[model samples]
Target chain A: MKAITLNSFGGPDAFELRDVPRPAPGAGQVLVRVHATSINPLDYQVRRGDYRDHVPLPAITGHDVSGVVEEVGAGVTAFVPGDEVWYTPRIFDGPGSYAEYHVADESIVGKKPASLSHLEAASLTLVGGTAWEALAVRAQLRAGESILIHGGAGGVGHVAIQVAKAIGARVFTTARSEQFEFVRGLGADVVIDYRNEDHVEVVMRETAGEGVDVIFDTIGGDTLSRAPDVLAQLGRVVTIVDTAQPQNLVQAWGKNASYHFVFTRQNRGKLDELGALVERGQLRPHVGATYSLADIPLAHARLESRDSGLRGKIAIAVVPPAHADARQPRA
Target chain B: MKAITLNSFGGPDAFELRDVPRPAPGAGQVLVRVHATSINPLDYQVRRGDYRDHVPLPAITGHDVSGVVEEVGAGVTAFVPGDEVWYTPRIFDGPGSYAEYHVADESIVGKKPASLSHLEAASLTLVGGTAWEALAVRAQLRAGESILIHGGAGGVGHVAIQVAKAIGARVFTTARSEQFEFVRGLGADVVIDYRNEDHVEVVMRETAGEGVDVIFDTIGGDTLSRAPDVLAQLGRVVTIVDTAQPQNLVQAWGKNASYHFVFTRQNRGKLDELGALVERGQLRPHVGATYSLADIPLAHARLESRDSGLRGKIAIAVVPPAHADARQPRA
Candidate 1:
């Protein structure tokens, strides 16, 4: 099978397209013919040797997958051959979905949304689960509340705006002026031009100086450290990034706010919930770019450059299908 | 009226015993003839100018108080003259409890426990509220769960041990060997001599390596930053100290734990709840040392030294009575 293998961690060029032996399903697992996978920030970090000590060498590092069940191992009763599935591979586990074939536990795979294409399903797996875990499970965002979602045009942020809106929350998001309309079109009630405006000031003013009931921080640094200033009393701040840095919580203490730091886990339950939302049209995947299996390096370069003007995820087509959906993205 | 005032922030010697105009109750207020007040870590921090910018200069900076209502202002129906009461003064509000008389809003004072003396009530007010808020309101510790409480012999930890036990939780506390029996007597199921034993090792070993469901951190620093190592998968770490330093949350993120930083607010409701516990003998005050009103500087020095062998809060007798309770703590 054709796969992108990292012999050494460095830059995008380190990903080499080569022939690799296909993986086999073990007990309670299913063999998947990976159709599409997507690029996440973790991929770049793993490829750059940021997690070199933790990740074994010569690794296939993609995490998000939309694939078809090719075979099933003994004791696996949940999935059978030819079933379409979507999931995020457990991080730092064995082989990843950057290959033509991969194996994953049956427990972590969910039936793909019937209404969406493989590329779309692959694009939403990791980021969609992260956003859902942050808002729904961790923060327990309730109806008729207000929320401030930073980085509204990014992968998780884009999905978060829709999720918060679906739960009947008034959504306020931050984005550059050029992306303001894009986020607003996705059901964001207010879009702050973060680069040109004071988000805290604007959010406070919009909420009558009481601050929002919840803050979803996809972007870290000062935005996360100072989140309490714009949070209502007893509100919550949820993040999936930058927990490595030391953050002061004196302000959070004064407001009695809770801070939830999530490193999203691979679980079939969250994927199933997100699939229901996708099927209901409350959430729709956004694929800003696509690449063939051999062009994995190019996909990484586009993500790292930050000039691709991508609004959501970058997809990689691992296998060509006989009848690709008309909505399938191409680069 | 005599008061201990800080004209400028500095060492304990900076406090001046001076005569000040007696405070009078305003609408919906009560004039409390303060019988006793307790020294908290915040009192020493304020005296050392750590919060100089936030606190008013020439401040009377005590917080916990037990007193008798001398008069009630217009619209104040909660208390009458000679009624015993206990409360925590709001932080950074005008004039604290380190004086002969203090005026407080009726909404923030509660009826004192009938069975406890004024000194005992004063000793428990601030610390009791802190412990209750951390465990009950923030962590929501459930019955049959396990908890680890740091600084078991200190102000907050002493009360936290009793509270967790009262909630039917198995409580583990950390203290020096000399204080192990003391914490155990307060209903701690396990006491680790932190000076010699690694609390994490002992706690994790005792819990069969699953770790405790909640950790109450009264003594901060590394104890807070590394708390995730000894926390259950979805456990909570509640702290009331050390919010100034940057702490890593990488482990917390991986464990999916929640961090709650509590800056306890002054409210009559919490005080009333705690008072009921005191009356039921479920909670008791432990005053390790006592100082006369004129010895405010000495009390600050004792707390700062941290070698005073004090097992609980250091208390101040603001207006010494003719016949003080025989159990009144002495330096």
Candidate 2:
């Protein structure tokens, strides 16, 4: 099987396309014939020596993948050969999906939505999972509430805007001037220009000084530090970014606000729910750009540059099913 | 009318007993003859001008009080003259429960329990509300789960231990060696000695490293910093003491632990429910010491020197309901 292998963690060029043996399904696991895989910031860290202790040398780094089950492990009843499934491969343990075939645990694999293409489904899983964990699992965002989703034009933020809107919440997102229209077109009630305007002042004025009900701090830094200034009493803030600098959040104390550090957990059932929402036309992943499997290096470089208004996902088209293989199989 | 007023902002002695006119109840308010009153930390802070911006000065400082209704404001229908009720009086706008008479909105007062004395009932309003808010609102401690309460013998801790147990959750509490028996007697499943032992080590050993489902942290600093260590995956940690030093709390993110800051809101319905719990055999406030109303200065000194293992609340017994007209009502 052709795989993107890192001999020594360094940079984009470190991803060496080498022929490796296909991964086998262990007990309670499944072998997925890779259809597509998506790039996340975690991949960049893993490709560098930054996560040396985390991902062992000679590791395959992709986390999100949508594919067809080629084989089932012992004692597994949930899936079998030819079953179309999607999953965010757990960091370190599972051999990732940046290859011809990958291994996934049954607990973290969801049936791919009928409405979504393999690339779209693959693109949505990881970032969508992150947004779901923060907004739904941690914050418990309810209807009639408001949220300020920083980086709303990014992968997780774009999906989160839709999810918040799906639940009848008012969403305010921060983006560059160029992407403001793009974010607003996706259901953001308010989109602030991060460069020219002060987000706290703009958000406070927009919320009539009461501030937001929740803050999905997808972008952390000085942005996260001042986030609490725009929080309502009893409001919640969820942050996923780990930064060296500390945020001054004392303002939240007077309001009795809560801070939730959300790192998405792998749950197959949740993925299936996400699949259903995608099928319902209520949720969609913006696959900002797609690259061929051979162009993995360029895809990663573009993602790491952070210069583009990449308003959704950066996905790689792996093993596209043939016309015959595309025929309906057991879902 | 004579009232204990804050003539200046400083220590306990700043309170001066002087003549003042009784305040009339506004719309939907009630003026009551305060039979017994209790002191809270907020009372001291307000008198010392710590809350000058939030709470106007030259005002009385007490909050919790049990008293008889003397007059009802226009449009009030819940009670008439002579009704027994208890409440944690609202801030500056509400002339506090420290005097012979105090006024509170009907929305913030509840009928007193028939089973307890005015002093015990007075104790119920603050600590009880705190315990309820920490356990029920912040932590959401469910049956069969485990909860660990730090500083289990303090004003709020003692009551929280019992409340967690009453909700069918296993309760663990930390206290000084001298207070172990006191905490154990309150139905704590496990009592940790902060003086001689490591609470985290003890808690980890008892739970086999799975940790508690919830942590009610009344003592911050080291205790709060260590609280998430004993939290199970997806567990909750609520703190009353504010942490002067910031913590990354990165360790707890792996377990998906959530930290909540509990600043209890004044809700009369919760107070009424707590009153019911007190009337039953489920909850009891430990009244460790008692003082005469005139000895309030001495009482504050004693309260300042509260040691570990002190049983119950430090209460200054005011005009006992038995001597209704013995002293002229302050207002």
Candidate 3:
């Protein structure tokens, strides 16, 4: 099987496309023939040895995939051959979904959404899981409350806007002026241009000086620091980005806000819930740009230089069934 | 009426006895003829003006009181003259309960526990409320879970021992060697001497390396910083003392702990629930010592000296009930 393996951690150029021996499934595991895989910021971090001590070496890059069942190991009764499934591999443990075929525990993987195509299914796994965990699981967002969602146009932010609205929460977003209409189209109640005006002032003034009930910050640093100032009494704030300093404790004591740092773990139950929403047309994935698997270097370069125009996830297309058999992605 | 007042912020000798004008109750208020008021660490902090920004000057020192209702104001229906009540007044917004007659909103006071006398009722208000809020409200301690409570001989810890047992949670406590029997008698499953042995090590060894589900710290400083080390996965740690530095970010995030700092406030619902428990013989107050109303300086002196034998609350008794008259506490 052909796979992208990192011999040493350094840069994007360190990933080598090479031939490797195929892995087989053990008990309670299923072999998946991956059709498509998506990219995430964590993938780049893991590739560069940022989490080297915790995660094992010579790792694969992709964490999420839309794949088909190829084989079932001993005691695996949940899945069968040719069953279409979408999943994220075990967090920092099992081999990732970047290769042609991978084996995973059936308990941590879910059936793919029936409505969306293969690429769309792959795109929804990482960002959708993270956004849902932050808003629903961590914050416990209530209906009829208000939320200030920072980075509302990015991959996770764009999906979060829809999810928060689905849960009946009014959304206040921060982004560039040029993308305000796009963000509003995704159901944001109010949009603040971060470049032109202060987001804290806008949020405070808009919520009648009481601040929002929750703040979801996909962008950390300054945005996370100001989360408490705009938090209502007994409100909560959640951030996905790592803190600026490892020891600088974030205090929201005066406002009675609980600050949570979310590193989204893959939950099969949560993924199944997201799949139901996607099937019902209440949730959808936005793939901003797509490239062939061979053009992964270009995709990585474009993603490293992020800007306002980036609407959703950047994906690596696995030939779309055109160049089959020559180098089958499901090999 | 004669009372002890704080003329300035310095040390224990700053309190002075004086004769002041009596106060009358306003609408929806009750005038209580205070029989006894208990001393708390908060009262000492308020006298030193440490919390001056939150609480103004010229304020009374006490927060916990139990007495007979002398008068009822307009629209006050639940309480009337000759009724017995127990209360902890809101510290900053209202007056303290350390005088001949004190005014409190009807929502903040509750009926006294019929099983105990006035001195016992007064001592139960502060420590009881703190323990209930930390264990029941914040931690939501499950039936089979375990807890590690520090300062088991102090006012808060003594009350917490009974409350944790009442909730069906196993408790491990740390106290002075002399107070070990007292804490164990209050239903502590394991007692460690905080003087010589390390509490965290004892808890770990007892539980076979699995830490407790909740940790209650009445004495902060290094205890708050090291509390996360003794917490199970997804455990909670709540503290009442603010003297600890905020350098425990790593362990807190590592174990995914929910940290809370408790400053017990007057909640009628919570106070009433605790009052019922005391009335039912499920909980009891342990009065460590008693002092006359004129010995306010001596009470403060004893607290500062950290009298080794002190096991519970020290209450100030009203001087010669026949000579006492209705007078509002200084705000």
Candidate 4:
């Protein structure tokens, strides 16, 4: 079984394609014939030694997996051989889904959405679950409320916009001027060109100075610190970014603001919720690029570059599904 | 009418004892002949110009009020003249409760608990409301959950301990060695000597390394930065202190922690909840010291001094209630 293994943590070049032994299903687990996986910021962060202590040397480190169950271990009742399944592997646990085959506990796996191809399912698994946890579980964003989503064209942000819209929330999103129409097409009621406009002024003016009820921050840096300026009283700010610098948050006190810092542990519940949306044609991942298993390092480099022009996720075709040519630069 | 006025922002002496014009009630307002008021950290913060922009010069800056209604303006129907009432004046609105007479909107006032004296009721108003908001509203602390309250012997923390206990939560509190029995008496299940003991180690050991479900931080500084170390997954950290310095909170991401920065806004609902707790004997404010209206400068200096050994709130007797001799060193 060919897998991309990391012997050391550094740049994208550190990922080496090697023939590794395929893992068998343990008790309560199911062996999956890997069909696809995707690139997320967490992958780049892990590859750069950001979480060096958690992932040791000689690690198989991909997270998302969209595949078919090859075998089920003893005590497993949810899945059987040849069933299509999709889920994020338990992060930082044992071997990951970078290989030709992978195994996960039955409880964490979900039936893949029938409407999506394996490439699309892999792309949405991690980012979709993350957006679900941050918005639905943590922030509890409700209908008719307004939410400001920072970096609305990115992987998690794109899913978050759709999720908020699905929950009947009015979405205000930020992107570059070039992506304004792209995000608007995804149900963003208001879109701000983040690089060319002041987001605080746009949101405050749009909301009549009351500010939005929630803020989904996929961009780190000053977003967390400036959240209070555009947040309504008793509003929530949910951020997936783990920034290195300390932030000044004294202003948040006046608004009685709640800040949720999410690293999204894996579970089937959120995956099922996302799949329901996908099945209903209300949610889909925009696969900005596709790569072969051996081209993971290239995908990593492309995603890391500032001018990559990646709008959503980069899917890696471990075993390319049919209709592979349907892949596009955006979606 | 005599009042303590802040003509400028500086040290204790910034407050000047002066004869000022008494206030009259406007529409939807009530004129309160303030019987007693209490000192909170907000008072010192306002005096030192922490909120200088919100509070103008020559401002009367006390918050908690316990008194008799002297008059009611048009559309004010909550109470009549001579009715006993307790509430925090709408913060930073008109004049605060630092003078002989104060005016407040009828909607923000609550009836004084029949079991408490004016000094006792005054001592509990702002701090009690703050603790209720933090523990009940923001944190949503539940039965069987564990909470860590920093500075459990201080003004807000004292009330927070009682509130957590009233909600059936297990309370783990940090205080000086001298105040262990004090906090324990207030229903704390575990008391850590914050100076001599490592609170993180104590909490981890007690909860079997799972950490506390909620952390009420009245002591600022590194508490917010280090909270992730002792917080359970999905735990809530509610802080009333607005520190001047920025904090490192990157560690909070992995725990899915929610941080609530609270500078409590005035409301009648929270005050009524606290009143119910008081009537049921589930909560009470410990008044550490008392001062006459003319001795406010001394009171301010005493509350500010580290060696003053104040355990809870310092009550100012504008028109001292009968049985003034009941004031004690500890209570």
Best by lDDT: 4
Docking model 2 quality class: acceptable
Candidate 3 lDDT? 0.79
Instruction: Please state the error at residue B283 of candidate 4 in Å.
Output: 0.4
Interface root-mean-square deviation for each candidate?
1.4, 2.3, 3.9, 1.2
- Give the DockQ (2 decimals) of all models: 0.60, 0.44, 0.29, 0.71
From the highest DockQ down, the ranking of the candidates is: 4, 1, 2, 3
- Which candidate number has the best DockQ? 4
lDDT of 3 by residue, A15-118 (tens): 77778888899999999888777777887777778778866667666788887899999999889998888888887786787778888998987898877666
Q: Give the fraction of reference interface contacts each candidate recovers.
A: 0.78, 0.33, 0.09, 0.82
Give a tens-digit lDDT track for model 4, residues B185-260.
9999999988898999999999999999999999888888899999999999999987557887787888889999
| lDDT by residue (tens digit), candidate 3, B41-149 | 8778788887777765565668888888889999998997998888898867766766777888888889987777677778889889989988998777879899999
lDDT over C-alpha atoms for residue A181 of model 4: 76
Can you give the TM-score per candidate against the true fold?
0.89, 0.94, 0.90, 0.95
lDDT of model 2 at position A280:
79
Cα deviation at B159, candidate 3, in Å, is 2.1
lDDT of each: 0.88, 0.80, 0.79, 0.89
Worst 10 residues of 3 chain A by lDDT: A322-331
After superposition on all C-alphas, the RMSD of every candidate to the true structure, in Å, is: 3.3, 3.6, 4.4, 2.4
